[model samples]
Target: KSFLSKIESYNITGKQWVGSESWITQAELASDERKNILQGAIGFALPQASIPGLREFLLSLKPSDEPQSDVIKAFWEKFFDCSFSPSNTSTMCNGTEDLRTVSSDYTDVTYFRAENNVYKAVYLVAYALHALLQCRNGSNPITGKSCVTRNEVRPDLVLEYIKYVNFTTQNGAKVFFDENGDSVAQYDLVNWQMKEDGSVEIVNIGQYDTSVPEGEKFKLKENTEIVWGGNSIQVPRSVCREPCPPGSRKAINKRKPVCCFDCFECPEGTISNQTSPECFVCPPEFWPNEKKDQCFPKPTEYLSYKEIMGALLTGFGCVGIFLSLLTSIIFLTHKETPIVKANNSELSFLLLFSLKLCFLCSLTFIGRPSEWSCMLRHTAFGITFVLCISCVLGKTIVVLMAFRATLPGSNVMKWFGPAQQRLSVLTFTLIQVVICIFWLTINPPFPKMNMKYYKEKIILECALGSAVGFWAVLGYIGLLAFLCFILAFLARKLPDSFNEAKLITFSMLIFCAVWITFIPAYVSSPGKFTVAVEIFAILASSFGLLACIFFPKCYIIIFRPEQNSKKHLMGKIPP
Candidate 1:
């Protein structure tokens, strides 16, 4: 009655329930209290000690109206004293039943009274006694008497039985002992769930076996089997920081655990590839791939005969070769004709042969770059073009001397004879040979991978070792062509019946134009396209020499038989 009196007078104030430093307020606390009380009333009702605290907590709500009073009365009616004594001192409600009284039957089992450890201990003692009884009858050799002493028991026999002890107890638990006498420990992972009425139940979620390897020892059910705290169903974490993502390396804090680290980006030419502890440099032959997290072998590039640009350049080079061959055949077939003979037929033959070699030299540039190809391609091209230009210079001098020898007092032809013509051609061609020999001996072209021109591909190409040497070879050829162009331009109006000065001038004009345009195109192009541009310039200039100089002569030799005679070619028309 005194406990009930304290509950009836107790009151709750907002200040008493207000939270000082958290989200929980007085209203939330009161609501939780009511929820616990209502849940308890529906299930098992409040225990004896909790009843007074619950009653006072409800009174603290301060109900003033009849509706509030009726609500409180209904809540109070749900809670009645249901405890029963063996003397029948308490009343038993219709819905209330004790778990012990509702069962059909109960059986006694050894597991309920004694745990598994007790069975293990009993088995250990029994094995020792059995071994003692068997070995107790054996007498010591020194005594020569029936020995019933406890010290006479064989320790080896006792230890042997204990190592292999295996049996099932009356409780159905299997008992076994290891050689070391240590019991293996295994445990069930439990999930504790709190009920709305402030009661807890442990759920067997999984198990851990010490006999298995460490990594495989613990196993759990699905995540849904465990209940998490607060409102989230996710597994809670207690990490110092989030894990670093890929393409970044972790800077571990030596003072903290491995999980705590700072993330930093991988440096250039290096990659982390994963959430790694450190970054590694890529191999020299490899470059960072598109994602920048991995290294891939760099693409090998060259002017290949199989590719589009290479095939096209090869076809053009073949065409130039065919044209030069056909022109040489026309000149050879008409070697006796005045037009062919008048141009110093031997020099013309040498020029056509050199032009054919020049066309074929461009073929070397259309294949994979190698040390041999790099050295041969440039040197062959330089030597062959010099030979062709020297022949042209020789023809220009012959034409000039022939026109001068026609004068009444001139003996220029006798001084600059065919021997002099051959000597001059050889001298001009030898100068280029010496230059190329020095160029190859000093700094020569070689195959190199051009990495900067294009990032995605490695340009497998010939790198000219000496810029000065390369330009010197080209400048010497240009100077000879310019001198021939000027001399031929001066003798363009010569009255010879088969003058070739005009044709030489026009061919040089086309040759200079092609090479001048080639410089900028070669400089601006990239990768395989640079090789393509060079091949195009070679074919263009070679074709210019072949077509402009010989196409007219080929037409005259094939169709104009009357013009081929020495009488008609010597400035004397048929009468």
Candidate 2:
């Protein structure tokens, strides 16, 4: 009562109270003022079984009856505040109560005069003595005598018999002690439920018996409702921290219990759906969302025509095509002029056509790479460049042959006429065509999702299936360009009237310089920039060839008509 009064003074509420049998029994037996403080508390109690005739014996007590001993007389006088009398007319003490019936205050008691554990102990000792004195065939197996004398009995001997004693009590409950000399553990789960009258009731809500099977030892009444602390229906939590939520992990506090922890969100590119020690990394082609709870497929990236860079490159390619066609128109209109005729008009027109194809091929590299575009981009670039170089090579040879024809009895014109020039261009271009066909048939380029180039996105670019084949095409174009550059260099010093070789030499120099830098830039560039570098190389080289080779002739035919005359070609009218 004093301990419960201390708890009541603290005014602690909403906290579950649990205790052993003695602690709970004290709460149950406390005065109403003290017991009210423990309302809704839960605790364990030793399981009780009703004792036969014990309630009847307690109710049958009367003050008129003689006390059995001095202690009994004194207890009866003190409890009832009256002495025992044989001839009392009233059966109650002080004429206010009947001794034969129990008081209303003690009605909650289940048994009288004996505790459940005390009853079990009495039975345990009786069984041990019974087994100790038992004789078989006139011989006591324990002591090797008909009956063991009381003087021969010892506390250790009696205890040895008590260790193996097994019996059932009057309530049909099996009683036995374990090797540790302890009886089977049995407890009743009790809850202190408050009543409307401000009194508390100790209700048996569950049971726990060690004699039952392992998992079946503890059980609760399914229909029984538990009354939590502070008369609340919800069970109070005693944990130090709440659980970590999804998309997060538990970070344990140092020198604290495992229940006490902090939650940390998953890092970028990793995902988790529960309280885990670590997050899982997303796959190569996947990325984690903002919440880091789910993985999504990475966005595909390519040099699309819609983006600013691709649009700019496409615009440049279109300009190149338009300029090439416009140059062809100018050459056709001035075909009769000395400048156009002097520069070999047939090869000049063919070179413009091939330059237009080169510009158009760069457009193929601008869009999303597919199977057809992948194959066409590289093959078309190789073939068109070879054809363009072939035209230049033929023109360079013609300049040398024409200069030779001016000498006496040279006869070089018959060996290298217009038909031979066309055949030479055709033969050189046909070789590149065959090489492109074999490259496409053996190991062609194809579109691929490049994952290693970036962490958060997929690069949709053309993958060259055979590096050797790709490099071989570039090598073959380089071989033709080098040959053309050397031939043009040899003929550069010829007379200015018939010599277009100097312009060809300058065009080949720009072409070779652009491509020589292109190899290193293409190799070092990353993601979509690699394709941009290649397209820039193609556009720069094509523009160099167009400006260097034809711009001078168009100026002569359109702006300098006097210089386009036969006297200018024969060097007869020098300014």
Best by TM-score: 2
* Candidate 2 global lDDT: 0.83
lDDT of 1 at 110: 15
- Model-by-model lDDT, in order? 0.69, 0.83
C-alpha lDDT of candidate 1 relative to the true structure: 0.69
Per-residue lDDT of candidate 2, residues 171-283 (tens digit): 75678888788878888898888776556667889999877789999999789989887677888888898776667777888989988999889877788875455688989
Please provide, for model 1 over 1-575, each residue's C-alpha lDDT reduced to its tens digit, 9 standing for 90 to 100: 34323433462211111112121211222233233221211011111111113233433432233434665334322343342223265454333332223222121121111234554566676855554454334652323445445665566756655655566544434456556776454545544344665454444466555556789877775663565444234565657787666667789889988888898887777777655557787776787765568889888989898988788888888888888888888887778777888778888888999999998999999888999999999888888988888888888888898889989999989988889988988998899888988999999999998888765568898998887778888888888989999999999998756678999999999988988888899989988888888888888888888888888888778887768777776778852
**Compared to the true structure, candidate 1 yields what TM-score?**
0.64
Off by over 4 Å in 1: 1-187, 192-201, 208-272, 275-284, 288-293
Q: Largest lDDT belongs to which candidate?
A: 2
